[model samples]
Target: MTMRNCTLFYSFANYGLNKKGRRTGKATLIHSLRLKEQLELKQKYLNKSHELMRTKNEINVEWDSSLSHANLLDTPCGMVPLDTFTQAQRQQLLLDVVEPPLLSTVNTSDFGKIKSRAKYKLSDWIKNDSFCDAGIAFIKEILASEDVVNVQHSIYQFNLFDMKRKSQRTEQLVSYINAHNTLIDKPKTLNFTNFQEVLFKIPIVNGIGTDIVSGKEMMQTMKEFIVHFYPDYPIKLMLLHDDERLAHENTGAHVHAFISGQNALTGKYDLRIAQIKKVNEFLFKRDGMSATLFSETGRLNYEQAGDVAKHMQEMFYEFVNEHLFHPKNINAAFHPESVRKSEKRKQMRKEAKLAKRDRPFNYHTRLLEDVDSLEIKAKKLDDKISQREKVVDDLESKAAYLSENCETLIIKRDALEQQCIKQEAAFQQNQRRHSKKIRLEQEVDERLSTKRKEEKKLDESILLKQQKHTELDSAIAEKQSILDRLSVMATQALYPIQKMLEHMNNRLILKGRAGAAEFMQHIIKAFSADLPTELRKTLIKITNNTGDTELENALTRKDSQINDSFDM
Candidate 1:
């Protein structure tokens, strides 16, 4: 069997305890004691397991010197440089030195009043709580005296929003110390600004076979792992039982830890938690424990999964234009003044103009320009022809006059008559040539007129086609926009449905029910029936076409196995 990798789950909660005791501070004391007992029991079991392995010669019995009892005794549970004490000693210090002052500062009546008003005024509760004030004062006193204090075992819950307020109070308390150190020209050691609080959860998987280590030991190992990864930053880890998860199941409760110190290297706390989970999967496997909280299919039903997939696709479509070749975001990213004068931008505009010149519309424009040029040439030819005709008429009148004086000057008249005949003949030839040229020009004009008419018809047809194309494009864009909006609405509607289904699935699984498959089928059918006619058809179509036979078969097989187990 392949080992499945585990994913980490984490969530944040509001800081203080509520009036109804949902998140009571006293629960911390109970959790500490319970954890101690559980750890001792686990240690005993592990020793027995080791002995059994040794007797069977299944494992080596070599002992590491670093984990020896003497070394463990010297290891302090809190600040290592300030104190030399074991885990037990640290717990004792908290119980004896811390609890006395904490309990005395907050009497029963005052505690009652704080709890009653906590729901309405959480900030006031945090500020007025005598227990918290006492703890803060006690720490300040120790710090002022430059004495080592180990109070790691005492749990102090503060709302994340109140960190700034708490920091201010801490600074006020430490002002004396800061002044005294400054007077002596010493470096500041207690700066609250350098630290931050991080909260994360680790779920415990039950019925995964016997646990090899206790929760405390697991926490210690995880802390060491983090320290190994981030050696420069100093960190402190405190484990607390998840109140909500524990309410559901007292045994094998989920773990919540508070990490206080410098921020993670990536600056994202969730990313740091994810890294820990990824590495811890193999670590947990090696230690004979399962880290997974749910099955491979997860808690989501098929419909819920489909809804999530659809939601993701809608989100992708919505943002796709911003990232993919669209210039909107690009234009927004740059300064408008700079972009307007940019050489590359100018080149792009020029290229666009050149592209427009190559269109069919531009070709029609060139044809119109050719027709105008032809008209100009024809007008110049007509003017030259008119001047030639006037010259011919003047020569004819001169010839008539010469004939009238024929008897007075006989020889000269004969010569003039011959000249007149020759000129008349040449004029006739020139007239025929001009007439032919005029006829040819008329024909050319007719052809040009026909071409102009054809171009006009073509332009009209092109315009009509373009109008239709534009309408189609607009219709498609409008439909797409509507579809996107509907998809978003559907996703929003399905979110709560998914959550409810997930919750149901988890409950069914926990109860070891064989009817989970039936329940899911009923839910899908009911949901489909509730949809509008068109939406129902679409849903049915998608379901019929996009069926995953493998997943279905696996679910069926699992259901059958569950039934068989119940039967047995």
Candidate 2:
């Protein structure tokens, strides 16, 4: 055997087989332990790598609360709820939340109080429990510690009235209005037009052309503004309601205040328009409010004052109507300066004048003059009634015209309804078609996806089969090599036996004895004679030992001898 073959046989006998050529357990145990150790090392490495990586959600925010707290309130940043606000309002809210104005240290108690006889007070009022105190605190931290009230020629914009928090502000406003109309420390002189200004240390804010800021939110901001900037100034905040500009949904409502801080400090009206502009700018920057400041020149104008006074009166009247005060009280409160007195006042006057003599001698002469004037006034009243009747007839004709117009409107509304129905039907049809198209598309996509998956699996299986085929080819090649080596070994092992037989045959032939080869061939010929005739002839031809020269020459031919040696 070759050296490689000998070594391979020895290894198989020692490791894989026992003396009887049975497989041993020692090699199997060693392989199992090696595989287990490698698996353990791989698992350990995976665990170590897992600890080194982290996901995106692992990190946390620091100031997320302050930035997003506004979203939770009914009114965020003094505006309406985020969902209800317009794009402009939302933008303004974001600006306010991002960078709030500096808040002054104005206390809630310092807000203007009502001068009315009402027993209720603002400080003790409830319902506004969760006010904008947090927002106020935030603002206070940002503002510089400057005396805004006493600053020379500096006009401060005030947000004075918020209708949202109506606990005591409305009452206080009524009292303020009452004070303006009716003089204090004197008998009631309720001249609303003459009574122009009432001073109070308060700020007012109300929404105009928007419903973003509720009365409560406005109040919150107003209280904070007064506390911070207008604490030292006279809080003369007024509520002005423009009935003409009033919106059905509470828009176009604004608060007005006389610039009294500068008046208190200098005792002279500041004429600088720059101060008003600066105040407006500051208010816009701080709270996103466009605070319109009235200069002294504008304030003194009759038309402006009249308009403001009218709105103020309307605000007071609106409150009175809502609260349902007695007519006597209303007359006393609103028309106290009128010459006509109530029954009680007349009685008190009569009781006080009991000590004085009564003078009534001119009564008869006055009665005659009063009767003549009554007749003339009655004739004028008759003419006025005729004119009013004519106006009523005109109104009746207009009503008839409106009634006809209503019929046309109803027809138009029916046409619109029919059009809407048709549009709705078309929309539904389109929706169904779209849905069907989507479903078809989805089915097609699913089929394509399934096909792709099948193709991928087929490709993977083909690759695996190719790999296995290549490995089988290699194994077959290796087996073929082993088989070739084994064939060579077998040939080498049988060569000695063939040579020994040849030597033995040569010896026998030289001694003139029947050699084993010749004797075997004669025995084969004798056995063939007892077989079938055909078989006997074939065996005789092959085993014949004839001494003819031609046959001997054929057997001794070079090609024949070479073929015989190779076959052996």
**Which candidate number would show the highest TM-score if scored against the true structure?**
1
Could you give candidate 1's per-residue lDDT for residues 1-568 as a string of tens digits?
3333222222222122122221222233223323233222322223465435433111101111121221111124441311234456545532431131112222433433433343234334345655456554554454445332233221232222234456554443344333333322211222112222222223243221113223343345435544544454444334433222211123232333333223335222232233233334444554556542222222456775444433322232323223321332211121255864799756754553332223332323433443444334434443543454444334433433432222212322333344334334433433324565466456545645654565555554664455445545554445435434543444333332333233333333322246555655553534432343443343333223223233234434544554566579
Those runs of model 1 whose alpha carbons end farther than 4 Å from true positions after fitting are: 11-30, 33-217, 229-568
lDDT of each: 0.35, 0.31
Candidate 2, residues 1-568, lDDT tens digits: the string is 2211100000001111111111122212111112223222222222454335422211111111122212212232433322344445433433332221221113111221222332134333323344455433422332222222221111111123223555444444344334322222221211101111221111111222224333343334334433443343343222222221201224322232222322244322231222333444454564575544445343447765444443334333333323322221321023353432677645644543221112121222222333334334433533443364345335434433433233222332343344334333433433323553365456545645654565555554564455445545554445435434433333332232223223323432332334644544433233322233343333234322221233224323533444455579
Query: Clashes per prediction?
Result: 0, 25
Instruction: Evaluate model 2: give its TM-score.
Output: 0.14
lDDT of 1 at 376: 45
Candidate 1 has a TM-score of 0.19
How far residue 437's Cα lies from its native spot in candidate 2, in Å, is 45
Q: lDDT score of model 2?
A: 0.31
